[model samples]
Target: MSYFGDIYKGIKTLLTGMSVTGKYFITARKGAITQQYPDNRETLKMFERFRGEVVMPHDENNEHRCTGCQKCEIACPNGSIEIIWDRQIDEETGKKKKMIDQHIYHLGMCTMCGLCIEACPTDAILWAQNYENSVYDRSQLTKVLNQSGSKLKAGVED
Candidate 1:
């Protein structure tokens, strides 16, 4: 009957699969193709296309290029941007100006989509190539970028 033929075929298929696995099990000791990860961290390389975390550079003048335009904040679908604005007297005009008070980044919620970089008018933010972002504490993943206590210069903002 066809049923009996199917049973014999199944048994033969099982044996064929077992033979392949047995060969690997016996040959595993010969040499490993796997590259040990942490042991060779110095030589570890990532693709140039990989997108990483965003970073902002603060200058000595305590001025960030971010013009409070909120283009990036608006473009983000998840609303992850938390920009704290503070009023400061513009040194040139001696008038109160709205500036970026603090820029907080929550890495846990970021998708690394690179949308924020394209949305930036001044190109103040960029994706750094360093990708080892693992950490034990979730709170530590949150980064504050304005620690330099400096203002951005004219015509250059990210």
Candidate 2:
């Protein structure tokens, strides 16, 4: 009786899987599930919530919002983010302030967890919509988020 019951359950599971596959197969001609890569690159659109890569946005004046808080680095489960920062004297305040020299992001080590973006207090970092990140050399994956000569945006408090 147990053997017959087990066989019945197996058949039910198989039929359930086949039904899902058949449904997709029937609709495959009308609307294909997968897109044709390279050819449809121009028409391809990613979902809004898709996490591609971490990026720091700089404005026209070459200013960023990152205050070198290192919160993103701390939140990262893996050592993918590295903030090289130092203390500098603010010309206006005339006091020592933390400033980021370089905000490094290693794409190869990133898990696309979005933790770093959440940890940022000033909304300095965000996920870039572009998904074409493939490269031949591993060194190309390591990126400096901040542009050259980019300074902290004015009025952005730490």
Candidate 3:
């Protein structure tokens, strides 16, 4: 009698587990409501919480918001940012000021962690919504943000 009761209890537990599995099998046929990645980009809406590419915004006057403080450089953990800056006299005030001599950012090494943006006191660094960054050559990924021909406006912080 005792042996019979043990077998009966085992059968009862197995049936209970199978019942749950069977229920889900039927419901799953109704089609998944989950979002499709990448392909559904046009239909998908990004939330405010999403953090993407880092962009250095230039104001209407062409002057950037960066003060060339080197705070972002110091804050970057991966040493991805190399800011070659020098002190120049502010033409308006005649006072020595920080000027961005050169700005280089390597996308291949960047972690996209937004630490650089957060370190910026003037809100110079912003995160853009573009995420499709694909390049064949590693050298192409190394971007010089500020160049001679296309300098980020003048009289930024200087």
Candidate 4:
């Protein structure tokens, strides 16, 4: 009797799952939740809050907001972010200040956790919307966020 009861329960559960799938299949033509990729690429849009990749925004003057504080680097759990910095004299204040030489991001190791963005005091880095990050070479995943000859924005250190 118990063996038959187990079989009956298993069949019931299977049918229940099938019914849900059947309903979706029946309505799929009307309004399917599944997206048709490549064909609908032009119409596709990612959500605003989607975390794609980390990027540093530079202004028209090639100035960024990063103060070389290293908070973002410290917040990263996987050591995906590396900030190469050096102390230089600030022309405005005549005081030595930390400036970043390179802001490196290893996309291969990043989990897209957004902790680095949150830890930044100057909002130096944020998520980019471009999600097409596939590459043939693993070394290509390593990116320098800061542009060459880019300097820290004035007053960002204060």
Candidate 5:
């Protein structure tokens, strides 16, 4: 309660804080718990469940499973997904069928929410582990999920 007593208490508290910092400083020589980012780039790995980005998986023949149902586009809160499709006549049946022209994913607008992945009925879209998504231009963030000349696999329906 006294002025000197209060001053002494403050000094003690300061010293206590300093002691913890000094302890860490001394122990840091043994091995730093903090990772040196660029140095650890080779060994660093992201977690399995980490939601980095949305991607469409394709088979060996470049055939994707996306039905272009627009579920992912609707589920996205930020409108990060855009499904561009067209009706084509199937040669076998001669029936008009919806085929995905392009599945555009805007990485810059994405919030890393897994709603799009969950909304995909055909399990077309999934979260990829590659987290580094930085780019100089915003236009570069808009990615087409399907590879060039890729097509839907046989029997994938809307």
Candidate 6:
């Protein structure tokens, strides 16, 4: 091709790109591609399957299904889960039983890989819908999953 032909081709390509941009600019009155995050916070919705963070759900009696199996702790790649357990004498059975003293989860250390939830045999841990995991202090990120003054429910298999 001639030098002029090459120049014409370049200009034609540039015009095609400009035309697409111009089309969008002209149609901007219809709607926007960008979301107004802060303004739309009240109506903003997340997907049902969105895995935000790990949480232990307790019943009205404050009883949880965690059996202190430590499966979640073992599955966590980032060492986010720590299950502190001890042998306690069951009042009914009068036999020593392995019970969880505390279930510590470090939100900051968690990569949200969902391995811990999947490994939970008792369905004690699940992905909560709450997406806001930010905290001002690092210490606040480490949370004890068991509620205060709560104990293992009766009849929970040892």
Global fold similarity of model 1 (TM-score): 0.68
Q: Pick the candidate with the highest lDDT.
A: 2
lDDT of 5 by residue, 38-73 (tens): 888889888899998889999999988887789999
lDDT of 2 by residue, 1-158 (tens): 99999999999999999999999889889986788989999999888888999999999999999999999999999999999999999888999999999999999999999999999999999998899999999999999999999999998883
Name the regions of candidate 1 deviating beyond 4 angstroms. 1-36, 59-63
> Candidate 2's error at 79, in angstroms?
0.5
Models sorted by lDDT, best on top: 2, 4, 5, 6, 1, 3
State the lDDT of candidate 3 residue by residue for 1-158, as single tens digits: 97999999999999999999989888986866677777887877666656665667665555666667889899999998989888888766799877887778888889988899889887877777765678788898887665453334454444
Model 4 gets an lDDT of: 0.93
Error of 6 at 110 (Å): 0.4
Instruction: Give the C-alpha lDDT of model 2.
Output: 0.95
**How many angstroms is residue 68 displaced in model 4 relative to the true structure, after the best TM-score fit?**
0.8
Off by over 4 Å in 5: 1-33, 156-158
Candidate 5, pairs of clashing residues: none
lDDT of each: 0.78, 0.95, 0.76, 0.93, 0.88, 0.86
Q: Write the per-residue lDDT of candidate 6 for residues 1-158, one digit (tens) a residue.
A: 68999999999999999999999999998867676777887877667778887888888899988889898999999899999999999787899988889999999898889999889877888888776677899999999999875677666554
Worst 10 residues of 1 by lDDT: 149-158
The local lDDT score (0 to 100) that residue 32 gets in candidate 3 is 61
RMSD of 3: 5.0
> What local lDDT does model 3 show for residue 124?
76
CA deviation > 4 Å runs, candidate 6? 1-35, 154-158
Task: Please list the residue runs of candidate 2 whose C-alpha ends up more than 4 Å from where it truly belongs after superposition.
Answer: 1-28
